[model samples]
Target: MQLSPDEHIFWQYGFVKLNATIVFTWALMLVLAVGSKIITGKLATGLKRSRWQNLMEIVVVAMENQIAEVGLREPRRFLGFIGTLFLFVAIASLCTIIPGFKPPTGSLSTTVALALCVFVVVPLFGIEDQGLIGYFKSYLEPTVIMLPFNIIGEISRTLALSVRLFGNMMSGEMIIGILLTITPYIFPIVMTLLGLLTGMVQAYIFSVLATVYIAAAMGDQGLKQEPEAQQ
Candidate 1:
C-alpha cells in the first residue's frame, strides 16, 4: 500500500516533480474557494433565505461558538483561520469516499505545512494581542529558569501536532487500502464509514488544540481554564 500521495508522481523534471499530494491539496483548496464564493454570493439578511445560506450560517455560528468555548472572547477575529483549518481537514477526509482520492493530510509534508501554519500563527496572534515585548515575556514566566523549557514546549507541541495528524490520517488510509484489496466488499465499506467518522473527529481535535495554543499565547485571561485556576 502507498503510505502517502507523495509516491504517486504525475510529472517530473530533475528535482522538480508534481505529485498527488500537491494535486489533491490544490483541488481541495479550489473546491473550498469556489464553494465559498458561490455560497456567499447571495447571502440574505431578510426572513427568507436559501437552504445553502442557512447551512453556511449554521456552520459559521457553530465554529464561532467553538472558538468562544476555547476562551477566545471575540470569535470572529479567529474564525477565518480556525474555520479554514477545520474545513480543509474535514473535507479532505470526507472526500475519501471517492475512489482514487487520497487525503493530503496523510502525507508528512502536508501535515508539517499545516502544523507550521499553526506554529507561526499562534505567535503572530499572541504578538498582535499582547505586543512584541509582552509576548516575549511569556517565555520568562514563573522564573527565568523555565525559559528554555517554555521554548522547548512550543517546538515540541508543533512537532506533536504534525505527527499526530499525519499518523492518524496515514494509518486510516493504510487500513482502508489493505481491507479493500483483501476483502473487497462489506468490511471495506464499514471501515470507510469508520474512517470518515475518525477524520471528522481528528479535524475537530486539531482545530481545538490549535485554539488552545492560541489562547495560551494570548494570555491566561483568554484561556478557558483561567477562571477555574483562579478559584
Candidate 2:
C-alpha cells in the first residue's frame, strides 16, 4: 500500500504528523530484524562492503560498547535485548519527519510497555546470574535495614524510565505543533531536527539504564567490579 505522504515518510524515516505509527514501526522492525540477521551472517562470510554493512557494524559496535561499559560480565547475552530496544526506540522516534506519522514513543503507553519488559527481564536474568537468594540479597545492598528504601527506589526506577521518555517526546511534539500552527515555515525544520536528536538520546538513555539495572540485579549492585561479581 502506498503510504500517504505523511505515513510513507514517517514509516520509512520516523517522521510524525497526526497518529502514532505503530503498524509502520512494527513492519519496519520486522523487516530490519530479518534483514539485519541475514546480512550479519553474510557479512561474517566476507560479503562485499556496502552501506548496509556499515550501518549494521555501527549498531553492533555501539551496543557492545554499552554492554561492556555497564559492566555486564556476560555482555553477549544482553546483546539481543539491548540492541532490539535501542533500534525500536531509535526508529520510532526518528520517523517523525513524515508529514502524517506520529511517534509511537510520545505516548506513555509505549514507553511504559518497554519499561515493563525491562522490569520483567531484569529479575529473570538476575535469578539466572545470582540465583533467587542472591538476587534478593543483592537488593539489600550495603545494609539489611536499608532494604525497604532500596526496594522502593528500585520500583520507582521503572516509573522514572517510562515517564522521562514519554514526557520528553510528547513535550517536543507539543512544542512543534504549537510552533507549526503559529508559523509553519522555517520553524518546523529546527523543531524536527531537535525532535530527531531528542529521540536518539532518549533511546540511548533508556536502554543504558536498563542495562545498569540488570547488572545491579545480577549482584553488581555497587556498580563496582568485585572478584565475585555476578556474570
Candidate 3:
C-alpha cells in the first residue's frame, strides 16, 4: 500500500529510520559472524561434530573457495574483508523477509559506505603489500606521467562501483515492490523468485568485486596490465 506523503516523510526521517536500521543491522551481523566463528570453533574442538558446526563449515568452505579463486591462494588474508562483507550483505539481503524491514542495500548510503569501506581497505592492503613509498609509486604504473590520471581513475571507479550497485539493487526492489502493489497474488510470487536470483547475484558481484579491489590495493597492478595494441 502506498503510504501518504506525510507518512512517507515520517517513515524516512523519523528517529528510527533507514540509517539507524542499517547501522544496527550491520552491527548485529558483525556480532553474529564473530560469535558464530567462536562458538563453532569451540564446539568443533570439543565434540566430533554438531549440526551448527557442519552448516557453518559448509559456509566457511564455500567462502574459502571463493577467496582462493578470486583472491588468489592466500585465503587467510581475506578472512576479515570477505567474511564481514559477505555476512553483512547476506543478512541485509535477507532482511526483506520481514514485512516491516527494508534491505539496507536499497539505500544509496549503505552501498556507498560499503564501497568506501572497500576503497579504504584497498589502500591499507596496498601499503601492507608494498611499503608506503612503494605503494605511492605504484600509481605511476608503467610511467610517472600516468600517475595523475591513474589516481583520478581509481577514485572515479570507487564512486562508480558504489553507484552501480546502489542503482541496480535499489531499482530492482522498487520494481518488485511496484509489481506486488499492482497485483496481489501471482505477480508477487514470480517477483519473489526473481528477487531471490537478483539478491544472490548482487551479493556475489559485490564479493567478487571487493576481492578484485583488494587485489589491486595489494599492489597486484599486474592484474590490470594493458594489452599491446593490435598490429
Candidate 4:
C-alpha cells in the first residue's frame, strides 16, 4: 500500500521536491484561509445571522469552554493557536471524502511540525507568564536533581505527540486502502466513515493535549491570576 503522501512526488529539483504532503498541506491551508475570510467578512450581529456565522460561533464557544475546563484562565488567549490546530486536523480528515485527496496529517513531517509548534509554544508561554528565570527554574522544582529528568520528559512528550498522531492517521489510511483491495466496496465505504470519525477524535485529543501542556508550562500563573481577576 502507499504508506504516505510523501511518496507521491509531483516535482523535484536537486535538493528540493514537491510532494503530495506539501501540496495537500498548502491546499488545506488555503481552503481554511479563504473559507474563514468568506465566512467572517460579513458577520451579522443582530437577531439574524448567516448559518456560517452561527456555526463559527458555536465552534469558537465550544473551543473556549474546552480550553477553560483545561484550567486556562484566559481561553481566548490560546484559542487562536489551539483552535487552528484542531480545525486543520479535523478538516484534513473531513476532506477525505474527496477522491484522490490525501491527508497531510498522515505524514510524519506534518505531525512533527505540528508537535514542534506546541513544543516551542509551551516554553514561550511559560516564559511570557513567568519570565525566563522563573520558567527555567521549573526544571529544578522541589530539588535540583530532577532537572535532567524534567528536560528528558519534555523532549519525550513532544516526540510522543508527533508519533502518536502520525501513526493513527497513517494507519487509518492504510486500513482503508487495504480494505478496498480485498473487501467489498461497501466495506471500504464504511471504513472511510469510521476513519473520518477517528480523525476528528485525534484532532480533539491533539488540541487538548497541547492545551494541557501549555497550562502546565505556565505553572501556577493562571491560578494566581484567577482569584485576582475575580476580586
Better of 3 and 4 by lDDT: 4
Query: lDDT tens string, model 1, 1-231?
Result: 578999999999999999999999999999989998999998899999999989889998999999888788778899999999999999999999999899999999998999999999999999988889999998998899999999999999989998999999999999988998899989989998999999999999889888888888886555555522110
Tens-digit lDDT string for candidate 2 (1-231): 221222323234344443334666566577677887877766744566777788888888889887878787767788899888888888877778876566777777678888899988989888887689988886677898889988788778888989998888888788888898899999988998999999999999988888877877775542346433222
Candidate 4 positional error at 51, Å: 0.7
* CA displacement after TM-score superposition, residue 156 of candidate 4 (Å): 0.9
| lDDT (Cα) of model 1 | 0.89
lDDT order, best first, reads 4, 1, 2, 3
Query: Per-residue lDDT tens digits of candidate 3, residues 1-231?
Result: 422111233245446554444554555677686878776666756557877787777887888787766644467777678767876776666655556556666667777888898888878877877779888887887798999898887788788777876776677667778887789789877776676677777787787777777766564442333222111
Each candidate structure's TM-score, on Cα atoms with residue i matched to residue i, is 0.94, 0.81, 0.79, 0.94
What C-alpha lDDT values do all the predictions have?
0.89, 0.76, 0.68, 0.90
Look at candidate 1 and tell me the lDDT of residue 167: 93
**C-alpha RMSD in Å of predicted model 2 compared with the true structure:** 6.8
Instruction: Give residue 187's lDDT in candidate 4 (0 to 100).
Output: 92
For candidate 2, which ten residues in a row score worst on lDDT? 1-10
Where does model 4 exceed 4 Å of error? 224-231
Stretches of candidate 1 off by over 4 Å are 220-231
